[model samples]
Target: MLDKTGDAEALGFDALADLLNINRVDREKARREGWRTLADLVAVHDLENSSERRGDEWGAGSPLYQACHVALIEFIRTAPAGALPDPFAPGEIFGPKLPPTLTVV
Candidate 1:
């Protein structure tokens, strides 16, 4: 689950597990093994059944996979081209300011 934060954080593999319909065991095991990014999880699972992970494996078909693919791509495409400001530099320290559409239980 994404924390309520305005600062765009790198979307991790665990976050996309539901969308990918990845099993819980695989997700938890991946997390324990320090698989942070989608590419990392793919590498561990051999999603393509090949020696190396390929981006094309997730292309087209499978609505859930498509959603993840689009979301990840859009995230990278729209990312700012500069380093982010240090959140702890000085002054006010506020909690995350996420999108209003998101609701955390």
Candidate 2:
């Protein structure tokens, strides 16, 4: 699902629904109104190049909007002491993540 192309020319969300036999606008309205289906729950994400209405909503940070700040802070902390500038702090809505793998040595 990670479209590395990030092609802005790709089809809009509703146009895609039409191909799947659902009217796009109607589907979105229903989802927004809380009538989401299993497929809706899966497909409704902060996708790249969303419909004209969505207009690039989610940036480098996912919908939670903390990764960018975290990366910035990490970058600043790693910088040389005298050259480092105060970095912008990420908001306090962080959560746990899946841990990396390891093996007994």
Candidate 3:
């Protein structure tokens, strides 16, 4: 069965109450935050942190660094021989172009 945060929270509270030998609320509070699972919460949290981490270089202990290292390893393992692009090759030209609606004064 798929695990939900609400289910875990309910189980945890129930266990805690049982261990403490005390009465607790019978109903669980409605979660309006939309995250239903631990994975969902983690994904949202990672996305929130990603923006903050973008400007900084990945440190050795950073999750981003670990993820990038794993990705690079997987890419190297699966990539076909000689499929990599040449870094010295001339790339497409990119520059600001005048808009068609503008006329020279």
Each prediction's Cα lDDT score? Answer: 0.50, 0.43, 0.40
Tens-digit lDDT track of model 1 for 1-35:
13355211344464555545566666677668875
RMSDs, each prediction?
A: 14.8, 15.5, 12.2
Clashing pairs in 1: 6-97
Kindly provide the TM-score of model 3 when superposed on the true structure, using C-alpha atoms.
Answer: 0.25
Highest TM-score, which number? 1
| Most lDDT-accurate candidate | 1
Clashing pairs in 3: none
Q: Which digits, one per residue and each the tens of the lDDT, describe model 2 over residues 1-105?
A: 234553212655544444434445556665576633323322444221233243344444233223444655777878787685333434323533446678999
Give lDDT tens digits, candidate 3, residues 2-41. 3544664566644533432322221122133443342332
Residue pairs clashing in model 2 are: none
TM per candidate comes to: 0.32, 0.23, 0.25
Summed backbone clashes in each candidate are: 1, 0, 0
Predict model 1's lDDT versus the native: 0.50
